[model samples]
Target: MGTFRIEGGAPLKGEITPQGAKNEALQVLCTVLLTPEKVTITNIPDIIDVNKLIALLSNLGVKVQKLGHGAYSFQADEVNLSYIESEAFKKEGAALRGSIMIVGPLLARFGKGYIPKPGGDKIGRRRLDTHFEGFINLGAKFRYNEEDHFYGVEAERLKGTYMLLDEASVTGTANIVMAAVLAEGKTTIYNAACEPYLQQLCNMLNSMGAKITGVGSNLLEIEGVDSLGGCEHRILPDMIEIGSWIGLAAMTQSEITIKNVSWDNLGVIPSTFRKLGITLERRGDDIYIPAHTEGYEIQSYIDGSILTIADAPWPGFTPDLLSIVLVVATQARGSVLIHQKMFESRLFFTDRLIDMGAQIILCDPHRANVIGLGFKSKLRGILMSSPDIRAGISLLIAALSAKGVSIIQNGDQIDRGYERIDERLKAIGAKITRID
Candidate 1:
């Protein structure tokens, strides 16, 4: 365990580049399993979850060579299929939720895939039914070992067909797409997740000779290729991190220029913050947020009802940013309801904000009503523990904006996603120190 000692009230200013998308990195790294040739990927975030996946790939006998900073070439010419049955594989595979994605590509290329009970942040129930169902739909036989809590899928040869997913699950869609890329016939996936991550995966697959259409739409069509080859891919900047910086700037009244945010793919994230009265300017590929001295005021609906901010699937406001939004709302001028529709426990971290003297009403497990103090009441920092990746950053933002020193334990959770967060924030003039 580690702790971050943050001295609040210092305005952070300067430019910081966003790390590569963690979600996208997971999908792209897993796609390397589909091809025997060298796949060179750049802009890979140096985070714990991503590193774990890379280690898992290396353990499975994929040749991994680090080329430079945030770049690697992976060649899976001789994958050790038997490693999946080893106890070490079970231990490594269960370390992160992204490990489950290895199943699809492995099954597609090697005819078999297995996953131990995966572990990740305990936010809510993240079911794997969508992934398994999609695989089964493509003619894979699925089985579960109740005693070991393991999942296995096998098929002689995958014959692609049509599958309408129950929801646009991001990883589920990625898994199915990777599996379908090398299947026998044409595969049509309706209600697929069209997040920039998936689109990048499709583009990378296309570069590797997989025939895929509908790159940025919910419905995707894939004509299975006999094989895939090496391709170079660069991941987009993490939009969730960009949104967090927006919230951090608002809360601390900082002038921050977030570089290369891929503004077109950010969807409603910018406008969603604008609803909370946070002003931002897009400079080509970057987003610049000036220090909010006039104080942010929540914007009500046209009919004059209180504003409600909730999360949805892609092209909608991401659930990951809701925590940052909730923390930012603490310093806003008016009250707003934050409904976290995706994860039930995500809103529970507001209790720590409430303890820090923010006016927050925990409506339930899934909703929070934040009454913005508008800087009239300043938050006094205290010792806190991080809950998850997103909430950990939210707490760090709160600590930075508070009136006193705050110590946050469980800093590993934050490092799992954000790459050297304290170092980056310090570069932008934040008063943060990491202690092991």
Candidate 2:
């Protein structure tokens, strides 16, 4: 674990470029296993989870090459199938939740895939049943080993069919798409996750000679192909990071411009922040946030009642950005209720904010009521530990806006998602230093 020593009460100003999307990178990286040819991916975020996936790919005998910064070429001409059963793989694969994605491409190409229980943020019960059930629907035999805590799927050959998913899981949809692209017949998936990440994956697969339609909708149709070739893919900017920067600017009264944010793909994110009374200007593909000297106010509903922001499926406010929204509301002019419907434990970090003098009521494991201080009360910084990736960045934003220095431990969790976060924040005039 590492720590961040942050000097607070400074306003940050300058332009910061958002890194490649971490969630998208995980799905795209796994697709490299679907082809034996060279798959070149650009704009790859040099974060811990992504690098770990790449390392795992190398260990599995994929020909890996680092072309340059944020660019890599992978050729899975000869994968060492036996390594999937090794103790090293079991340990390494369990370290990342994204590792489950590899099972799809591996099963598509090699007729078998195995993974240990994956690990990620302890937000809620993220069941793997959707993924395995999708596989089984595509004619794969799914099995789980209770003694070893391992899940395996195999089939001599897959035959595609229609499946209406129980839930529109992003990873589950990506996994099923990867498998169906190489199956014997056509596959129709309704209620699929149509986020930009999945759209990019489908586009990349199309370039590799896979037949897929309905790129940006819930219903996807994929026709199985004999084999797939390689193609170059450039991931979109991280929308979560862009939203974080917007919240950070409002929290610390900073003027910052987030560059190349792919405005079209950011569904409802900018508007959701605007509902919190945060002003943002879209300059071409970038977002400009001016310093809020008078501070921001939460907008009331049409009924003149307290506003309640909740997470929903695609096109709704993402559950990931709810944490940033909660943190920013601490200094707003009015009260708002944050409902994190997807994750139960994500709101537990609000207790730390309460210790810093913000008024927050934890209604339950999934909801919190925030009473904004309206800049009348300045927060006093204190020591805290980061619990997860999004919470860590939210705390960093709070610390930068506080009255004194604060020490944040377990910053390693933050590095799992953001790329060189401290260095990037430093470039924007934030007094944050990473301590080993």
Candidate 3:
């Protein structure tokens, strides 16, 4: 557990570049196990979750080298398969949800993969049924140990088949696609997640000699290959972080510029913020958010009904950004309803904002109604604890815009997703200190 001491009520200004997509990094790093050649990846974020995954790979005997800042090379030619069954591996794998992804590539290349029950943010019930079911559909034998909370999948050689995923889960889709890439025949996946991160994974696999089509659609077609060769891949900028910055700037009346956001890939995010009446200018690939000196105003629907923002699959507003959006709405000039359809318990963090003097109604575990203070009544800072990664960052943004000193416990939750968050915010004129 770590603490963040923040002195609030000050606006931030400067250019901050978003790190490589955290979601994309996790998926791509696991794909290195699909080939024996050197795979070089650039723009990798230096965060706790990603570093933990890298360390887990190293422990499994993958040759990992740091070429430079945010760049690494990996070779899985000498992987120690037996090491995965050890106690150390079990402990390590149990700590990260991303560890589940490694199973797909490992099963594809080695004909077997095992992992301890994975753990991650405790936002809601995230089941592994999608991943295991996808494997079972592709000719793999699945087994689980209830006593030990371990999962294993094995097959002599996977044969491709069509699968309509129960849900368009990003990780589940990535895992299934990785396994299907080396299957014996063509694999078609319907209702797949088509997020930019998943698209990047498919493009990277294609570069590595895997035949995949429908790069940006829910339906994907993959032709199995006998073997995969190494290739270089670069991750896109973190869109979630960019959205957070946009929220931070509006809430605190800050003039901040987010550089190289890869605008086309940020589907519906910028426009979604604009619905809250925050002004964002497109300066090339960068997003320039001028200080909301007059305070932003939320837009109502055409019928003069209250605005509603909900999460859905790709091209829809991401569930991850709903926390930030809800927090930002607290300072806007009007009211909005945030619907976190993808996950429950994500809206539960509004209690922390309510304690900070923001007017928020926690309608349920999945919905929140926020009445904007419009900067007339400044939020008073208070002691709070971060519940999860997205909620942690949302609380940090709220604290930055509040009045007086604030203490946030479990700052490590934020660090798992954002890289050197305090350092980056400090550079942008924020008063935040980390106590370990």
Candidate 4:
């Protein structure tokens, strides 16, 4: 297990650029399997999860070439479908949550797809029923191996149909959309996840000759195409990372400028941060966060009620940043309730922050009430292990603003999402070291 040794209480300065969206990269990379031609993806974040998926694609016989930093070209003209049934693939696919997505594209292009029970952050029960159920709805036969926890989907040719998703699952929507693009008829997905990442997948598919309408909305209409061609796609900056940087700047009282943030795509993120009384300026395409010398105050409702920030579907605040918000609120002037409605165990990380002297109540599995210390009491560092990606970064941010040194075990969790995080923070004057 790798570790991060951080010396706290130094305000970071200089400019930082957000990495390409990790979620978007996962979805788009799988799309390479949909076509036999070369699909070049730029702005790919150099992260663990994305790299693992890329490696999985290569193992499956996708011709992958490194164009340069943050860029890769992939061609799946000679994919080895037999590899999906191998023990090696089962082990590899089981390690990554994103691997579940490959099944859709494979089942669409080939006659079948199989995956082991995919693994990822143990935040809660992230069911794969949505993805397989969508495939079943589109005329694919689904099978599950009870002993090995493996899943398989097979069909001669998928026929498109209407599907109203049980939940607006991002990965599920992306998976189903990929399959539907090569189906026999029109596929209409209602109550779909309309996250910018999903929208990017739809748009990318459209560029490759798939007729997809309702680019940025929940209801998506897909007119199946006989074949899809190659297209070069650039991923948007990761909003979750951008939000983390914003929280880090405020918590450390730093003046940091986040460059090329794709302002329009960052729905409700900025305003949501502003609600915590953090001052962030929009300088052209960049976000400039000034030092909060006097500390920030949490905003109240119009009726002067306690502010409650909750996660919802797209256009609402993202659940990924709720951990960052909870950490940032630890030092704010007032109290706020962070309702992580999406995942149950995400709020459990608050116990680590509370150990650092932050006043936080883990109200339940789903919610946490944080009473800001207003910087009156400085957080002291302690040895802690990162539970998940988002919580790991949140803890790192807390460690940065704390007094003395903090050791973070299982640092790979943070590295899975954030690209070169310690090196990036070091460039901005943060005293962070990676102890591998």
How high is each candidate's TM-score? 0.99, 0.99, 0.99, 0.99
lDDT of 4 by residue, 139-173 (tens): 99999999989999999999999999999999999
Count of clashing pairs, candidate 2 = 0
What residue pairs are clashing in model 2?
A: none
Q: Itemize residue pairs with steric clashes in candidate 1.
A: none
Candidate 3 local lDDT, 1-436, one digit each (tens): 9899999999899999999999999999999999999999999999999999999999999999999999999999999999889999999999998999999999999999999999889999899999999999999999998998989999999999999999999999999999999999999999999999999999999999999999899999999999999999999999999999999999999999999999999999999999999999999999999988999999999999999999999989899999999999999988999999878878888888999999998888888899999999999889999999999999999999999999999999999999999999999999999999
**lDDT score, candidate 4, position 171:** 97
**Candidate 2 local Cα displacement, residue 91, angstroms:** 0.4
Name the lDDT value of residue 347 in candidate 4: 85
State the lDDT of candidate 2 residue by residue for 1-436, as single tens digits: 9999999999999999999999999999999999899999999999999999999999999999999999999999999999999999999999999999999999999999999999999888999999999999999998899988999999988999999999999999999999999999999999999998899999999999999999999999999999999999999999999999999999999999999999999999999999999999999999999999999999999999999999988978889999999999999999999999988999999989999999999999999999999989988899999999999999999999999999999999999999999999999999999999
Residue 18, model 4, lDDT:
99
Candidate 4 least-lDDT 10 residues: 342-351
Query: Residue 164: error of model 4 in Å?
Result: 0.7
* CA displacement after TM-score superposition, residue 380 of candidate 4 (Å): 0.4
Model 4, global lDDT: 0.96
lDDT of 2 at 228: 99
lDDT of each: 0.95, 0.95, 0.96, 0.96
